[model samples]
Target chain A: MRVLIQLRPAPDVVAAVIEPGVRATAADVAGRLPGVVLDQAFAPVAVPRPVPASAYGDPLSLNQRVEFSYAPQDAAVLVRGEIADDELSTRSVLLPSARRDVAGVFADPVIHSTPTCGGDGPVGHWQDVARLLGAPEMTVEGHDGSGVTLAIVDSGINAAHVQAHLGREVIIDTERSWSPPGVGGTPGEYPVAHGTMCAFDALIAAPRATLLDIPVLLSPHNVAGLLSDAVAAYAHLRTVLEAMPAGSRSLVISNSWGLFSPGQDFPPGHPGNYSDNLAHPFNLIVASLDQAGADIVFSAGNCGRECPDRRCGFPDRPITGANSHPRVLSVGGVDTGLERVGYSSQGPGRLSDRKPDICAYTHFAGSEANGPGTPDTGTSAACPVAAGAVAAIRTRHPATEISPAQLRTLLHRTAEDRSTLGFDHDYGYGVINPPAVLESLGRHTRHAA
Target chain B: MVLLTVRLPPGATLADALARLELAEEDVDTAFGLVPIDPGTGLYAVRVAEEASHRAANTAGGPFSDPPIAPHGSQDPHDRHAPPSG
Candidate 1:
């Protein structure tokens, strides 16, 4: 019964609503109403405290933070009132509002992590991904992503392990990179292998690009912690990118994670719903990043098949949330046989008609420093592979003002069509054709000159 | 609510153990279905409706269903884009 009470207070009423006084008034009002028990009130702050690096240390972690509220509105107060469905409808009439200054009420929905590993037994090689995308030829032509940066936003990256696997110096900009502020471990230093595996996979395509490891998922103890922290991390990322030098090469953000099973009772407007609605904090942050010219990529998820592979049975609705955002490139997984993997999530994404903008190889092997084997596979593997390819092209055309939209167009136009026709749900436009994409970019460069 | 820890033999998948738990579609109620203790170690924390409690205990390892322990602690707490295995 968590509710967000949005306050619309005039200048004179603003103080009453913004201060703890409004909460007291609401509590008093709730006391009179039958079956209503006022639980807690959250005052609005102009600027939220930055999320701490460690999950347990942050006081605000457990409570809801007002990400965005309308102007002329004060703070949103959270309350728990036990009332029956029929009586709940009377809340608008019974709850204190005009004098107390509350505008709207909405539920605060909980979000969960979209739940990876591979090594040794059946190793997936980087060469397979490169060959699948025809990247070796491009790599030979010197488009190995020297100047660009690929930011891996995931649990945390094992920078040391990635460097060991590549057998060379790989730059991981810790200062420029972000994690929640107070977290003790450095990027890739923590035990999580997902980030490290992603970093290794991205390097396979763009070996020279610098890695920016932003570890947003800190609740190593709970899955809900992983899902909830993402929104805040994106907000922090927006701030960091906004402060960076404007003329520097735009970054490629690789996110190989998303919400898979949004339970039955989830609301349409809830952030966990992954709706295309622009108001969602996650979508807003993604839109901001796209406007800043960052190429954002996301994995489509792994719920394609029935019981054996996916825990959620069969996905009724495949893609949602940031993965469904039109601005970002949503990727699906294909195996070495150039066929869609049984577990690769399929879609007509929540927001867009055509989803999984493209496919890349899965079960692709890469080095792992923390675990026993090369545990990088799935669309998680595909996303970084696609990101690395994009970085290489950005490196080749460093001065070109290739916006996110333009890059998406280029990928769509140049992709090798594999499925039904022009664009299919499983393969999107087709398999990512790196050499062809670079060739298209080359033509654009020549034409512009 | 029945909490049981089922240990899987070598080469056994998490899905295999979950099937052994006999969780039906109607029986599935939580936000997440399975919480892995250590997939490699084949250990899991299975929470099922009380009716299925006896069946969970009947598995080979015998149900350590007294009070369920939390899943294994890993350096990584987040989900990835792919399935846990290749």
Candidate 2:
């Protein structure tokens, strides 16, 4: 019995990027030989057939039938049906080295620039933040971040940043672009300094954690993409992480990006809150990562004054913003003196839960270079600092696999609760006391050795 | 869980070496990625780095108690206005 297989048509939108190989473009069956189908093109769920992303890669040679079968159903059907000889294999579409960098959000050395808005500069506060983390006293000696790999998903890191240098080649800096060129060109555009700052914070915070700079958003260009493609890029990040050895410790994922009903172009849900719009890949991605034993840390969006409940803008309903997602270690901002940044997003997460899982000072950060105090704000710069601190804790308690919940609980337990009314939304888990956190978790071996 | 930067043969698939080394996919994913080192080198490469927890395992003693710098205080900052915007 000859079986007919239905394949996912290519995304039509990508056509603008590449030249269509004539097989599918031209008339008959004679020309369409080497064209095979990739399984991922179609999701189990229903999605309108998008304009097929242009078929990149060179054309299939005449008569060179590129055959592929969906292992999902093709295998079962082949066994059920009385079939002749059939070729079966996991299908992957031939793609152009079309891969580009996923920019990271940076702080400190990477930017050397300031927020158009406010805050203390990296140079201005570098000493202060480092001091807060117990720099000289902690052990200037490097431990190799020795074997640690912390993924920094933000604007994209500056490869030359001082923090990138501290650990040498430990930085996996990838740049993502906003509106990239047809073929892969310069990273979508130089990623804004955000991802770079995040990377710097993480590297300095953990010094020993190997840094993987995954650029999810490019700034000054391709900003919209940062929101849409984040989840997929994160999944792709998992594909990278899985390639590591087992018994890996301190598997940290840091995200310093966010949104709130950003605008019309955003998919369905608000980058900040939930919407009738598309559900962000963040929640889904975080839950999956948590299951895989990776700790995720994200920024509380900069939605301070525009409180959805008290005084939000139009359509400012409180949806589960980035900090609201469970399974993530959400962070808000504090200034150089460790005061909560007025504009930093504060929240009781998804279900009226207190958020900004913890707080980190973004306003006054120190630098590796001698620069003036250029102001900055937003949890974008704060999240990575907290992530780096987590790296330090994880580094110390190597044996204990602290679940996201436990880590949050531990932070709360060890936290020097500020307000008489502990756990308030304003400071969430209160300020980050790196020494106390380190002291609390104490020394332990991996797997209780 | 040491971070190793290994160079693959020309036209080598990083996935294959990663599989051979029995490296966890997470490490491969986090440690390595294909980047364009030189504009058109188009060569593929993989980076491998361990996590802090894993880094701790390799340590002879334990987590370093003596760090280079001292921890900063988490005291509350006094609220002040934006020094009068001109």
Candidate 3:
């Protein structure tokens, strides 16, 4: 059981207390409770701290220090009182209420030993989908994602296999990439099947974009492992993005995983619920990243059908957690026939007006295996495909510098509507028409010029 | 540099072909070495060194024949939400 204690002390108290070290200060505070143990304290950095406002409250002001500690589950009542003393503004219990299994979180690609005969000649399915989305035209226009950087935040990618399949070295940086403290192995070394598949799918559209492989998920762990470490992983991601040399090029992040049921109710501060509340640490972190100009993308889970799979439980609600956040571009999936894939999660997002900001092709062929024809399917496939398209536009017009909100608006306006006449739960804005998006961007560029 | 489309006999699995071909486990890197043309049906288009073509064909037995590289049109029936089946 983990607990986050928010301590608000005057600047002088902070200096005096912190000068003695965070552990000592926490020990002094924890003296009130016998069983609680001081785990870690996050102090504001002298320079602009990368920690989110929700992490310590009003990060810009640097008035509070946050400490994460653990105590016996039975001692919750005793610990809660000591941490909520008059000096403390608020206290949050970061206990894991339920275990979120990683079973269906990372969608596995279907491996076909031989290509199925028929339909559109020998071209791969991704190429056909690309042509449908006007990617060929974008490629013709020299927007093959040359100047963009796509950070894949999932399980670690198999860099060698991805490079071999794509036949190029597109992973420019893995130096800033990381796994949790005890999760060993270099980011690129872990042969995480899901991350590699996502990399392949994203590269299908933005073949030339440099990949920043940040593998948040590790082996021998479940969804709870990722959820517990996500805050730190996200903080590390911000650092990685901040370290990039100043440039006009675009930065896009593709997250192919998310929590669904959360196993708890809203407004109760469940660890799994990355609710829209600005005070929610996870939301604040994502919002901070958005303000810093990284276009984040999340896969709407494969819960569209009756939810046979554990990951896609058919809840009464439309969507859940971070995928439903307003700032991120949540993506759903469609088959080649332009119908919603039975498993793509639908939405009237908890935060956004309508979710799945857009849809793209699943059943995609990409670099999951040794070759390019591996059948990588699911909304996991769709999120990166859409991200690659965004990267392609960013590659072409580096100076355009669109905000996250503006980019969402452009995609929503330009998408080819499907399902119902306008926005619906299943299709969101509709299938991405890359050619239309490029044309709109072209017009915007010319107008700006 | 030759690409061979090896179709498995009815009831034959990819593991069977790999064994018959005598390719070491290390030699077949699933990420880039063995290309799956149709994963649903056990048909693979493998790019082998020129000298290994005959051995691959002979290993494939009666089902060994060249087929045109077809466009992938079959919908994979596997659910992405389910735990991967071996």
Candidate 4:
């Protein structure tokens, strides 16, 4: 068990005096005690003074704990750990309590409480229902959500969405969390007006799969999240998921927003610019998600000259070159006819290589005639549709049959070419055809784990 | 510990910047390497020296600080406790 030891600060602790409290505690913690380790108070995980390690438990475990420094700059080091000493180890250290603001403030199950999928609002992709159910493949076996979880990394999804809460059957564990610099409320929510509409697209695709909606956007007054903050939010989502049973197994992630701000390179010391591998924290977060074998889908940016790359749109450029390395399913946009959307982001990323590997639907350049402005007009909207499509495909096949990366490769290999005979710059591996994809899947006997 | 909270800009990444801070400090080289931070939602869990957070109080509410903990509007001109007003 970890205890937060608040020691009276011995002045001269600030200007590196005596190396600060948490440092003091870390220095004071000798291996002789067999419990505490000296730690720098201000690290990514936040360890307050003498950071203690509890190896004996789980999130609910009576032992282990992951601590963060409450105030690195302050003299006090706030350390959180399991209760180790016998005396304080009552049945359960924290007795259940009926706190004041249970409903409006603190609610039950952080991720499950919000509205999403089948909750109350409109499902933008309901039109694809016919495409989903009739896909001969999904119904091959029964719905199996046992070990697979879909991590919808976007704005917070509404927990009340009917499909997410009710629907076809039972998916034992599903969740959601709002990590922010959230602009409005604490949990950055997926409103009818949120984050390029990727939030709802996932539910429309896989209503019954266990889900983890990690809301990265936090601004209350706007429709989207901040670039820098979005990166951090994605990172936080990874940490939160790392601790859960729902976190393990094959995961599918969907990200629609893209950076359109040219010359967005922050000064050498800017927050957006990180190491060689990570262009931003968001990039690192995406890489981390990929390392976890979570099948991820990113909108190939709706910056193609077909439509204006105006507003926050980046010319639908494939995530390649500098944006390469962290391999993921880069999805380009397609029209209803399985042809590439003129507005689909063109590729070979900034480094000009390894362009978009997959393709999905964007409304007639996004809006038909005028196209469906909100849900279909952008590649952001198209990314989620592809995500949902993958979910349906996964449910039909089983995780052992198809890993996220494999799924990505298969989709690309079988894509209908919108370009000449083979791979093109705009549409990627062409558009995704459900029946064609299903047929292709039947040909392969090799299972993916 | 001073908690500051603020929304991040659309294309900016909170973790990337945080990484810069880590670069100069060997103790926290990759502080946010495996662990990433999202700038959009709530108080993201992070660690800073108590004095660091206190000094952060000088720039407090800008991002890591939020309500139920710090006042939404902190009076200090160098208020790290208050986030950039919406």
Candidate 5:
């Protein structure tokens, strides 16, 4: 958390800060705050102390007319710094008492122009996303998702619709694909809907990657599926992952779905609860998959405070269950213009805080699965798009060579940080930068060689 | 039906699980079968009636909630609330 520290440093230091052309630094006014990393670049500024103009006026209340005094003894010096996000509450309370000179500590929030929201139009086309991701460059360097198997575990995918929109041959590994009980349609033949959009978006970067169509969401009564169905779907995927030789195994699962309402779930502290309980069967399975060398990517959900999906149920910290799993990459949405969409769920997640681990492109003109010209919008689109990038990298760096955990670290390290302070809830480790990831990989490969 | 996990050796079938838990054939969702949650841990899961889950509580892990999940995106961007299935 970025902060401004008001310190009643020595009178001379305050006068030095107030003096013209003196150029006093943050270190000069507030030196070595225990928990705060002082911004060396920020020059210390003298803040005038407000005194009641009339003797009758209350000294504490600012409701009456006040006089601004820059007297060296009365004035305070303001210095800039950041406290660790996790320790913000503890440190903010302790700072004033820890130093007698510390007059107050205040928040320094990131100010931004209006954020893009669900109702906003598409920012750019899918081709623009390709360009930003450096798809052509990735292909030239042999990172085109040649052998990786990317799974879309959502509504059944319509292969024809995805192929038509992608203008390329789509590979549906039918032999590996599986459907939930009573879901009638064959893999890749369900309908033109969310799953098809996810497929098209994933193919943007990993065109050659084999896709395993696991339509876990196609329940007989409705398009939505129970979380137990997903447990079964993942169980099937575990087998597919184990079937591959350990030395070359690479399976990426994309989940653009999540539990919308807590009313459907057991309450938070209950033993049967799914949202906050790590011991829940589904959460355990997610861990099992991660341990077995699968890169799982989940949408952070459409519960952003700015403009949430109507179905959003949790009052706060909506990223829940496996969507907030530490093992998986919880993807949030940003437009092609790299502005975060208002519907992307912010974190301090239910399961693991500091979630929505990264942002990826969405609200783009592609996969007209929604309609004639509707943008593939939401963290739903972002999840698979990021999954596709993972597949592209997995083409060369298999699980055996670079484990999924290591790859996650690499992606987090190489991302274009959106916040002045790293890893904020809104954008996580900033937007996913494929070019930077590829470069980092190139450097590591050469180093290893 | 709720989900429950039981410790079973690798390659154990649904019948084996039913027998081990002393559950009648009709007590579980046969179509859902016995799915492995973690083969390494010998942990397998099955969907069973809430009463069946309680009956097997001494041996099984949970009568875990199986909440409904929907896709994150709406069908139409213009109508942000449009259901994904619409």
Candidate 6:
């Protein structure tokens, strides 16, 4: 066990350790101590003695008033060394009594940088994310989500709250926005919550895109909605897509909600299963929507191996159902520093092996939906951020011009590959590179022109 | 309630779906109606009670799982907006 030994060798030696120019080694101070293997490289440090400030104050307890004194006679020196693990307790108790000069022996525990967990503070602000995504350059280049329709299929959106945080007017297509069967609330007027945060993140790159508030998540059960509701919601969105002209259709659906447990689902191989079965009604609808030229993006859940969310119940391959569907872009989370957030789920997804198709900025200080100073966190936030990037590209290149399959290939090809070989489960094809995508689109546009 | 899918011609209604599946109105969630999964493929979905779903599954597509879903975020378990129990 590594430990710090406190010794009151002599006043002159204590003064020498405290002196700026003078150097005092462990051997120079203590001479020799038995059993402890002294660390010769570690310089001895002088520790201040605490003196009681009041007559009633106890010197041993710091709960009362006390003053730290650096007087040579009062001060003690601390030296680093290791002792046998078996004899640690014995030596710690006997060291001071064994040597008259030995004051105390204290533990020197190892420490490390704490990885950002679920409840931790934001890593950086949203503007830093805008910079990381090269949002300004994309906006300046005319890929600013004009005339595009971006749908947020989550709880419900509060346009006022989203507008306040974004510092801009939010365009809600009241005519197109739809709610589930029994869900009550007007389009863009629901309470501020998860859906609003998704709206705010998506508009970062595609501010001009019209938002379709599809609150499939709000149901009669209060905070919960059945998968059947999502199926019905997708059906409404299909009509919305069909209403648009085929040659100019541009609808980007951002889904930040998913199933967290297999308990509710039919077992994997069951005929009615939704997790790994593409034949399931919801999965089929997702495929139908993708086939109809809607750019769908889903969050790769918060069930990461290192520090998973408490609600994650999937024992393995947490990315399941439509969130793992091959047709959609499954987004994982990364902080503004470009490091994958510890809670961003890794892949080898059930529906598609190369899931988490790309990563995007998250865990940043944005939308005060959760509260002031809280980050827009989880792969939930990252999904819309990547969806926003796709919307930005769609501003100039409609789905008719660049098919969803073709666009997905471009994103994978141009991604900033994080691993030595091409792809890995952790980062998939790597972080979404908006600038590279824009550049590629520009090249295609010039060639077509 | 469980979900069941059926194929119908374009512009099919809940009445048309019920008549084709041979299910009565009481066993179906009328509010949910008949949702089109693929308009081009003439595919539609309906919500029915477990027993009705089993009977309809013979002709319709499923007695499929209707699992609950919630937003994926780092929220306090006791918070009002926490993800729903499975």
Give DockQ per model, in order. 0.04, 0.02, 0.03, 0.03, 0.48, 0.37
- TM accuracy, model 5: 0.81
TM-score of each: 0.59, 0.53, 0.58, 0.52, 0.81, 0.78
Candidate 6 lDDT over B18-44, as tens digits, reads 999999999999989999998889999
Lowest lDDT block of 10, candidate 6 chain B = B77-86
List of chain B TM-scores, one per candidate: 0.47, 0.32, 0.42, 0.31, 0.84, 0.84
Output the worst ten-in-a-row residue range by lDDT, candidate 3 chain A: A98-107
Off by over 4 Å in 2: A1-124, A140-144, A163-170, A173-192, A219-222, A262-281, A306-319, A365-372, A396-400, A443-449, B1-86
Each candidate's number of clashing pairs is 15, 109, 15, 106, 0, 0
Of 2 and 5, the candidate ahead on lDDT is: 5
User: What is the C-alpha lDDT profile of model 5 across B1-86, one tens digit per residue?
Assistant: 78888999878999999988888889998888998988888999888898888899888888899889888976554554443221
iRMSD per model?
Answer: 14.3, 16.3, 20.5, 15.4, 2.5, 4.7
The lDDT leader among the candidates is 5
Query: Model 4: runs farther than 4 Å from truth?
Result: A1-137, A143-147, A159-176, A181-190, A220-223, A240-248, A267-280, A312-326, A364-375, A396-403, A434-449, B1-86
Task: Candidate 6: give the clashing pairs.
Answer: none
Q: How closely does chain A match the true chain A in each prediction, as TM-score?
A: 0.68, 0.60, 0.67, 0.56, 0.78, 0.75
Best by TM-score: 5
Query: Which stretches of candidate 1 lie above 4 Å from their native place?
Result: A1-124, A269-276, A306-309, A313-315, A368-375, A398-400, B1-82
Q: What is the lDDT of residue B86 in candidate 3?
A: 6
Evaluate model 1 with DockQ and give the value.
Answer: 0.04
Candidate 1 chain A: worst-modelled 10 consecutive residues by lDDT? A112-121
Candidate 4 lDDT by residue in tens digits, A282-357: 4544655565556677666645554433332233343422233336677776545455544456766653355676
In angstroms, give how far residue A369 of model 3 lies from its true place: 4.5
lDDT of 3 at A180: 61
Put down candidate 5 lDDT per residue, A31-143, tens digits, no spaces: 78998999999888889999999988898988989999999999998889999999999898898899999989899877777766777667799999998888888988888
| C-alpha-based local distance difference test score of model 6 | 0.88
Chain A superposition TM-score, candidate 6: 0.75
